[model samples]
Target: MLQKVPKQYLAQTRNIFHCNCKIKIPIEFSEELLERAFEVLEEIDLKYNSYVSGSYFSCINENRGNWTPIDQDCVEMIRMIKKVSLITKGHYDITCMPLLQLWGFYKENNHSLPKKDELATALEKVNFRSIAIEGLNVKIGAEQEIITGSFIKAFAVDKTIAFLKSHGVADAIINAGGSTISSLNDASHTAWKINIPDALSKDVFKTGLQINSQTFSLSGSIDNNLLIDGKKYGHILDCITGYPAENLQTGVLTKSAFLGDVLSTALFTVPATIRDEVIAELKQHFDFDYFIIDNDHKKIVTECFQYLR
Candidate 1:
């Protein structure tokens, strides 16, 4: 099962990454440092949160098809997300809000699977290219909303770590909602230790890593998954098919938390035809490994991926 690093090693806080998050410094921080961390969380939550009806992101979506002024942070964040979408060849789509809504994965969820025609209708509004960004102004296609649930929390953690470093703090780790994770300079050990939970089994991770200066991300739809006639269905939907992806889950490591976050999500859904290209793009930027479990409950291995077992 997933567990936190021992409490003794982390200065903890809640609702920071839409969940509990931590910052571990080699040495302890003063109350001031903790306060600063919370401040960072508030800033990110205000700007990037997609669920809040009045958040900046909401307004951006609410003003779809018009040139909406946005914060500089959104510009950078949008650029980063768009870059990943490009590299993944639409596999990492930011404009999947309508598709998510159809599947009852949006804020106003009905918890019922959508009909085929309903899903096809929803897919009409799902296009990453619909997002138009020109300098500080942004626009989306009518009825389009860019959902950042895939990486906003991860971005927040990355920002928090930068904030801490600016304060002359080093040696820290951040876990965002138990998915996006990042670590800084080493503390007690030569590297940080993390486990990639077994995608095909319960409460187990055959592989764990010792690393520093890297981010790890896991995307799995097992939680809140569908069960029908003793068969299971994950929540991740294929962008092309409007159906649940065949892969049960995917895990990846990279230098950018945002990239790791996007990779895990996209790789879990997209077909193998585009998998190598995305993996190659990642390898060009950082040393990485991946683990993918398909619907057949078989692990797909690659030269770049080594099993811990």
Candidate 2:
């Protein structure tokens, strides 16, 4: 049964979910419902967070050569990850922990860059094909690790929204650090307005978004890029080159936060020469809305995005 909170009782809480990002879920302020939301967050962190010592991803990394048992939920996540990696030509890889470590993003308070030799060594172990998932089992290469830096937070929000909706808690929003947004319904049954941030100049425009039944994800080098010397390097690295991806920023609105997360990263990392083909291939699985700024600062705003405005 749904306990309806009075209109005056609307509230929200923030907590550190997976990836150390705060998850803000707006609710009707029922104590039991609030606790249930926290429980969902806790469950996801314990089972799938790679940073956690005993999590399934950690177990898979520590025992790379051996097949590690995974839960069905983990299996579903991996399957989606594999599909994204494949269609993007390995640009959107889950086996990216080594690359992150080499680039100094994996560790806190570290600003070191890897030497050429060290970069080469790490690149040798980075490949999506190295990860094999069958049923509830997963195996990686001897040194490969799957890092969900791009997807885990969104996954957590998606699941939390699912839990809320099941409890008759509709018409809410889940925002994770202003990057991923999940909605059970439009903001109070109105268009969920959003201002698309400009990647280069950091300007905000008046024409925002009106979203419904969707999760929106935006990826860019500016938000989380590394400034090494005079060079700007994106946190997103190419699984093939083992280097930071080219200058790019992209936004995707889709039915699933998992898909939006993967697609946004993939769009940012995939080679520009063949990006359209990859997007075309992705369409067979999902038709989505996107906003992309290319290396030349050329904005590619799809029709789907314009229609939302």
Candidate 3:
């Protein structure tokens, strides 16, 4: 006989994307299926993780001036990233690795401020428009580099959610390092409850939000930051300024986890005065809402932003 209550399966691992990833399915599922889902995540990590030696992404960075052959999936992902970059007016760029490295973000215990000349040189190679894609071949300008830290993990989660849905699984939530979360809930489970943390305060949750079959991505200046001489420097850098963005936090909700991840990072760098204009322009191409906390702790949210008390 079928069990009256559904069994929940929760799995977690810290190997993929160098972060703690968790997936919860509140329905009876085979262990093999669960393992396959994690395998999917690992497969993505192996193929495109730039940190991995000889990976596709690393190869592209290695041969910056030469065209490299890429698969269809790579082409699509790059195209999507370019589209968002165009819409955001270069506020979010995958080619900002030069600036990231200049600020010592990619290193441990070696964070240092860059000199004026160093910052200028890094900014010269930070243009996303320089990434050229032709057919199955892609190339970047010389001295240019691409970093997938912003959206690659979320992209993997979206792929896993699609896989789960294909196998008749309905109620599931995948959390990638507490930064990106993608969910699939059926009528049986209407939504997943998520807590929103206060950006200025530690150990404080401001509110709880409910998400249904959507992705929630949060980018904050407080997390994964470096302190140099008592000044906090966040990992999210502004491509134009060649410095860390000043926004405290930005949150985005979208149907695609990839989009959510990219948008959240982009929004964090956008200035508050013109943020509404950027959001309006984005709405024309995508369906999403956002909330941002500025440096002054002022809350800015779109009219369509939904929150549950």
lDDT of 1 by residue, 1-309 (tens): 987665344366566645777666644667678777768877788777887677778888899989988889888878777776677677668788778667665444354567889988988888877788898999999889888778788777778878888887667787766677788864644567877777766478776776587888888876646664566666677767777778877878778786788778878877777777777886675456777877777676654465532
Better of 1 and 2 by TM-score: 2
Instruction: Record all residue pairs in model 1 with backbone atoms less than 3 Å apart, i.e. clashing.
Output: none
lDDT of model number 2: 0.77
Give each model a TM-score: 0.86, 0.88, 0.93
- Model 3, 58-158: lDDT tens digits are 88999999999888888898998898888877888999988888888768786467999999988998999999999998999999999999988998998
Q: Whole-model lDDT, candidate 1?
A: 0.74
| Tens-digit per-residue lDDT, 1-309, candidate 2 | 999864443445566553233333344457677667767877777778887789888899889988999898888888888888899888778787788878887556555667889888988888888788877899999888878778877888888888888877767666776678877774566445567676775465534676787888988877666767767777888888888888477899998987898899888888888888998999898878898878887777788766433
lDDT of each: 0.74, 0.77, 0.85
As for candidate 2, its clashing pairs are none
lDDT computed for candidate 3: 0.85
Q: Ten-residue segment with the worst summed lDDT in candidate 3?
A: 300-309
lDDT head-to-head 2 vs 3, winner: 3
| Segments of candidate 1 deviating more than 4 angstroms | 1-10, 106-113, 186-189, 228-230, 281-288, 301-305
Backbone atom clashes (below 3 Å) for every candidate: 0, 0, 0
C-alpha RMSD for every candidate: 4.6, 4.3, 2.6
Residue 241's lDDT in candidate 2: 80
* Distance from true location, Cα of 76 in model 2, Å: 1.3
